[model samples]
Target: MTYWAAIARKSFQGGSTVEVPLPSSPKLIGASLLPPKHDPFYSQLFELEIQRHTTIAKRFDFHGSMIDQLMALVSSKSNVKNPTRVEVVTALLNRCIVNAAKKNNDPLRPFILFMPFTIQNLLNPLLPHKLVENYLTFFLVPIPDEGDLEIPTLVSNIQKEKINYFRKYKGININQTISTISNDTEDFKQNNLANTRLTTSLCGYQFYDMDFGFGKPEKVSIGAMLIKYSMVLFDSPCKGGIDVVITLEEEVMPNFEIDEELNTFTSLDPSY
Candidate 1:
């Protein structure tokens, strides 16, 4: 294993970044997925340790100065698997809880949650009740009023987990009130999936256009880039809502990084 691969495989619990060599082969015989994500096993135990120590790291508050640099160095650039803090946390919660559900085969278990803007406020009145379970609760990265958050491990973890688990499991009984994207109606045929209530709340205007302070944008749009190379999104509220979280790498946020070389490759369409 190369140095980067070895570093990525090692648990990254605390740092902002870790340099990792790209993996030579697709298969990681024994490497970890990625680090700085709340390791489910580690988190469950650490929650107790922090409580025991009674020093500083409080529940849901681990980013303080109390954690050492070595602990923080876990977030690495591992394209071989999940490579960001957000990706790792989402994967852990998704895997451990979904694995538990699949083990028991629950009839109404939800592996991937869809908190679409069309259905954000539609969670059941008892929805608060579901969050108490380890599998159910998901953290929401608080975007500033302008719409962007810094740390991303918690929500990113859920997205990775949902995508992987549902992609593998063929079908799931989801109670949803979808306002759009109606292509997959077959999954809930005869079932009351449609009856599952959903609601949404929209806020703010698409202000990325008027760049009052940031200066004229070389490019701008609704922001969707899924290619292998660099991924650029200038918009706010990236994935589901208005919050976009990516690694602190130029490969992920090109404009934010501002490299003159890659600037030549940019193509712009205002209508987009």
Candidate 2:
């Protein structure tokens, strides 16, 4: 990667430009139609519910500092300074999960979560290229069967469980793992693939300084048709703000949009 960056620098010094082909290391994997064999009833049940549900898309702009503030509060309350972004995000997700559970008529059911994990070299100072790889990973977060617990405890528990799972299975072949998890067999008996409900992605990436010969773009965004019950987090064009693009069931979307806690940080019609 550094060698390529040096080559690019040399090319620019010679007053010439080069356009290389896109990297092919990461390939796209389409959605799988495999069933959860152990819990075929639940699989069929969610599928039927999905068909009857209507999808809706909405973009929300919220104060960026809200997360920082939440982090500060968490730190002060727990006497643990320097909380990571993931902690704050987990808190936010917990809020959403609780809200969704309240709106959901079913309590004993679990939800499917599909989040894209990006492996990028940008953060590695030794690597000087913008190449990145992405994998759609699945996680099952358990909601209460009856009422709820405290938000901080819920978030901390989920994060700890996830960290432990990754520590136990880190560096294994992701493709093989995904294949085994997706297959309808006994291999996934101990896994959590059978009960996933909500999907979320953190897309608020910043490449504002990326340039060739021209200046930076005024804005950047991902324009894709998302599936229902999914949420995407994006960096707003302006500073001190974040954008949440959510796809939910049509009936539930309006209720979600009017959520009091969510509305606290949201801007009024801050459309892009």
Candidate 3:
């Protein structure tokens, strides 16, 4: 059986989060660790805080009118000296955005954005042809003090490393080789619990959109059928809010097996 080779990756970029899900696989990993919530806006209102406690640079950007409105709540802290905490970091980015927004009066300071679910370019499978077993995508919020790079640039930076791993693995002759995600934090512990089944939470149409009732869907989410796996932030107009679908591989699968019964049925009626 050709099975998906799964692994975990994480970022202490700002918030605390441990991710599990190798890139070769069709979806993102689980969130075992979450960073401390700095903005009352993100956690207080939305009930979720994304990782990115501190970056080596100055600012990170979030897009769409939905994300923009949420950004407005994190007040600027450009001038705070000796800042190390996630909440403190929030101010610095906000300050930069405010000044940039006011200087050119551009309400939205566009950041490098990539919609991973849009695989139009990947129809031919742009990924390395080893049938990528598993992988994870980390949301990198570079320091505000740094210059901006487009989504393609960011994707290139990440893929370059993993593809190299796949190359070396085949060079040595392995059954579906794998890439080792750097152990930045302690969150990427190996969980080898095979016989685990996948479910909708890890694969398909989830609960993040039932309330919209056909109103442009709030955001166009990709599904598991054609897309296999997908994840995108569901931004809200209300302050201190952002929803993330950090799907863990194992959690979703086992449920699916149980729900479907794995094509197994005990013969209560015996044929003579």
Output the number of the lDDT-best candidate: 2
Across 1-272, the per-residue lDDT of candidate 1 in tens digits comes to: 13333444444423546443343443432112111233354244334433433221101111212122212432432222333332332222222222332334533332222222221223343233212111121212221221111123433443454454334322322233221123233332323321121111112434433432234344333332221111222233222222222122122233322333212222222233
Q: Which lDDT tens digits does candidate 3 get at residues 1-272?
A: 11121221122222545343334433222121111224332132122211311111111112233233322332232222222222222222223333433444334333321122211222222444433233322222222223322222222333443344334333321212112123311121222112111111122333333332222233333232211112223332233233223222232323322322111211111111
Candidate 2 lDDT by residue in tens digits, 1-272: 33344445556657556554433343223223112236574465466646766776777666668766766776776644565544455456546644764676634454433433432221222222333333334344555443323445545555655555455345545344455345523433454533544445554445454443344556655442335655666666567455666666666666676677766656534453
Provide C-alpha RMSD values for all models, in order. Answer: 23.9, 7.4, 22.5
Alpha carbon lDDT of each predicted model: 0.28, 0.51, 0.26
* TM-score per model over all chains: 0.20, 0.61, 0.20
Model 2 off-target regions past 4 Å?
1-50, 77-83, 93-132, 146-149, 173-195, 210-214, 224-226, 238-241, 268-272
TM-score of 2: 0.61
Clashes of 1: 14
What is the TM-score ranking, best to worst? Answer: 2, 3, 1
By TM-score, how accurate is candidate 3? 0.20
Query: Judged by TM-score, which candidate is best?
Result: 2
